[model samples]
Target: MREDLTFTSGGVECAAWWYPAAGATTPAPCVVMAHGFSLTREDGLASYAEALQAAGAHVLVFDHRYLGDSGGAPRQRFRAGEQREDWRNAVAHVRSRDDVDAARIALWGFSFSGGHVATLLADGIDVAAALLLCPFSDGVPRVLASPPKTVAWLLPRALADMAGRHVTVPVTGQPGERAAMNLPGEADGFAATVRPDSRWRNEISPGLFATVAAFRPVARASRIGVPTWVGRCADDVSADGKAIGKLADRAPRAELHDYPGDHFAPFHGELPTRIAADQVAFLRRTILA
Candidate 1:
């Protein structure tokens, strides 16, 4: 069963989708999920949330302030700091619910917000546990290292943003037209999992590039005292796998799971379910212990 919910953050009402644990009556452990850059709460999160709910955990999946179904002006504008606040807001809302155990709450993030969790840990949010899926940690370095198709448009756009110029880059054009971050196989990767009706494809504001460069989560990860798990797609070219591995090494309590596939493959092709299972099993042994 699923329900719609909302919470206030930074004076804006943020929206979220909630999945209740099967047969759950009393308060239960809950996982609050945050999505990656340019993705709405429904893009690929529903699968994981539903799987976790079936595995006996409540799930709260929310959109970032300025993206998707959430409340925020200037759609698709990326703000790392504000997004962090949104995570805290989502957690607080989930914890306040009558059917959730405040002490047993877990933070889940993928890609962009995957790194956000690291920052949250640095801030001492006190979650029972945390999960990172193909997270991006050092944005500045990664953006610089990104392919030209990505850097070409993203860098200039971010610069335009710095000068207070609102630059709009095309989301895509030709069949192989790049969407800033689509690597050699990324277009195909996106096509595989994204439904034809999915509207997530787009060129994010150049401001997003600026925010990414200024964001750094790896340095703060070591401060996390909660048990942490990092899942990686060994073949994920979109995200910096090496940096993710480093985050696991830096965290006080951490483990790494290297799945055998590309980034989106793990989101589909038998991996999302497997990853969910691993996440639930790990939470059971670590947080539920």
Candidate 2:
């Protein structure tokens, strides 16, 4: 069963869904999950959470500050540092629960937040394992891949947002558009993950460009000492697949899986189920063992 709840993170209440492990007799392992850039827990995370819960692991899926049902000002603001803090606090909250095994916590992140998992591991958050799907490990490749015109159009808006202006941009659009993710097939792939009842907005603060460009989670991969499963989309245009491979290689105990299709492929169709099966298997071998 699912329970809607709130947890304090960064001085605000972040909305979350807690799914207790099915028929667990003892304190069970827990997986703390959150979505990628500009998304909420309602977008496409419930499937994975339910799968984990069915496999006898509690799941805590939450929205970051300033988005979805979370309590915060300046809605849709995406800050990597603050989001990481939210992840840390979520872990702490789960660990404080009597129904969860404090020593057997795992972190699950997708797309942009996949990088957050790596950074959190590097910072020595006492998690047992990590599951990263289509993680944006390095931003340089993505910056270089952006179309020249899109870059030009986004630069001014990014600058304005950095200079205290509330400039906003589309999260996804047609190729050559000024949106943050505008590669071929990206818009459709992102749309496929959105539920009809989801309250997710397409707009995000333009300052996200600068944050993403400077963020390089792959650089800290070698510092992660726990078991990590890195799943990459072979044809992902949103996040660099090659860099994700390097992350797996650099991480001390990481296994890499390459799925078919683009960055958003794992969120829809039969792929997500298959991926979740693989993840649950990994969790069973590691945290839940």
Candidate 3:
């Protein structure tokens, strides 16, 4: 069953969906999840959460503050540090639930949030397992992937936003546009994940560029010290596959899997089911064991 819930993070109330484990007679393993980049919970996350719930794991899918149904000001802001704190609070909320097994909790993240999972684990969140899909492991590659012209166009706006101008930019756009992600197919890939009823916006604070430039989760991979499953999109342009491979190698007990298509592939069409099944199998051997 799915129930709407809210949790506090950084003094803001964040919205979430709670999927109780089916037929659980005792405390059950729970997977804590959130969306990537400027996306919200409704953007293709329910499928995986439902799959995990069906496999007897409680699932909690939440929206980061300032996005989706969450309450926060200066909407569409995306801050890596604050988002990580939201993940921490979400895990803490799950652990407080009487029906959840605190010791068997797992962290699930996609794209940008995927990097958050690694950082959280390295920072010692005490989770038992982690599932990352097309994670943005290194910002250097991401910045390098952008066209020089795009970078030149975005930098000043990003700096202006950082200086309190609050400049907003499209999260994705045509190849020649001045947006965060404009690589061929990236805009369409992101659009495919948006549900018809989604409240997600296509704009975000330009300051996100500054955040991505300094965020490198791959550097902390070795400190994760937990069973981690890293799913890489073989053709991803948004998140560097080579950096993802490095993350898998550095993570003490990580298993790396390659999927077809680009960054958003695992969340679209038949891939979501297949990918969720693979993740559930991993959980079966770890969190749900």
Candidate 4:
């Protein structure tokens, strides 16, 4: 069963969908999930949500504050800190639900939110388990992967945006375009996951770059005490494998899985079918068991 819902974070209402497990008993264990980067909950996450639900875990998928159907001002803004807070608030909202089992709460984060999962665990939040898929874990590696000139060019724009004279830039662009994540195959990867009715924006306020640059989710890996699973694509250009691996290794109970395809592979087509099986196996062996 699926239901629509909302919860407040930072004084803003965040939109979400609650998927109850097919054969769930009352107070089912729930997996709290959210999109990454400039993504909305509508962007091909339903497959993942459904997969988790089929495994007998309730799924709660939501949009971050200021994105998608959620409430916020000035729109299309990205802040790692605020998003982490949103994750915390989301989990709090889940606990408040009478239908959820607070003792079995879990988390699932995709792409950018994957890193956020690390932040949540780092903060010592209690959860039965967690899973992060194709997460962008480190900032310096991403910046180093981008063109030096583009990084230099964006610094001023980022500063300007922080100062409230906001400057927006395309998230991905051609080689010489003034964009933030304009790297090889980046545009194609983004295009592949966009659903037909997606409301994701191409442009975003750049002030978050400074925040992103300072975010090193891996640094807090050692603080996570719950069972965890981390999935990564071997050739993922959008993130650093070493960083992700190190984070997984640092987490005392983290398991890492490497897939063959690129970053977008798990989000589309037959690949999701395979990835879902792996994720379900993990949940069964760890949290849902």
Best-to-worst TM-score order: 3, 2, 4, 1
Which 10-residue span in candidate 2 carries the lowest summed lDDT?
205-214
Decoy 3 TM-score against native: 0.98
Ranking by lDDT: 3, 2, 4, 1
RMSD in Å for model 4: 1.2
Would you list the clashing residue pairs of candidate 3? none
Residue 62's C-alpha lDDT in candidate 3? 97
What lDDT does model 4 reach? 0.87
User: Could you report the Cα RMSD, in angstroms, for every candidate shown?
Assistant: 2.4, 1.1, 1.0, 1.2
> lDDT per residue, candidate 1, 35-65, as tens digits?
7776777678888898888877899998888
Q: In model 4, which residue pairs have backbone atoms overlapping below 3 Å?
A: none
Q: lDDT tens digits, residues 89-193, model 4? A: 999998988988899999999888998898888898888899999888898888777788998999889889899885788887767787887887777778877
Q: What do the candidate models score in CA lDDT, each in turn? A: 0.79, 0.90, 0.91, 0.87
TM-score of each prediction: 0.90, 0.97, 0.98, 0.97
Clash totals, every prediction: 0, 0, 0, 0
Q: Per-residue lDDT for 17-93 in model 2, tens only?
A: 99999989999999999999888888889999999999999999999998888988788877788999999999999
- Deviating ranges (above 4 Å) for candidate 2: none
Relative to the unseen true structure, what is the C-alpha lDDT of residue 267 in candidate 2, on a scale of 0 to 100?
81
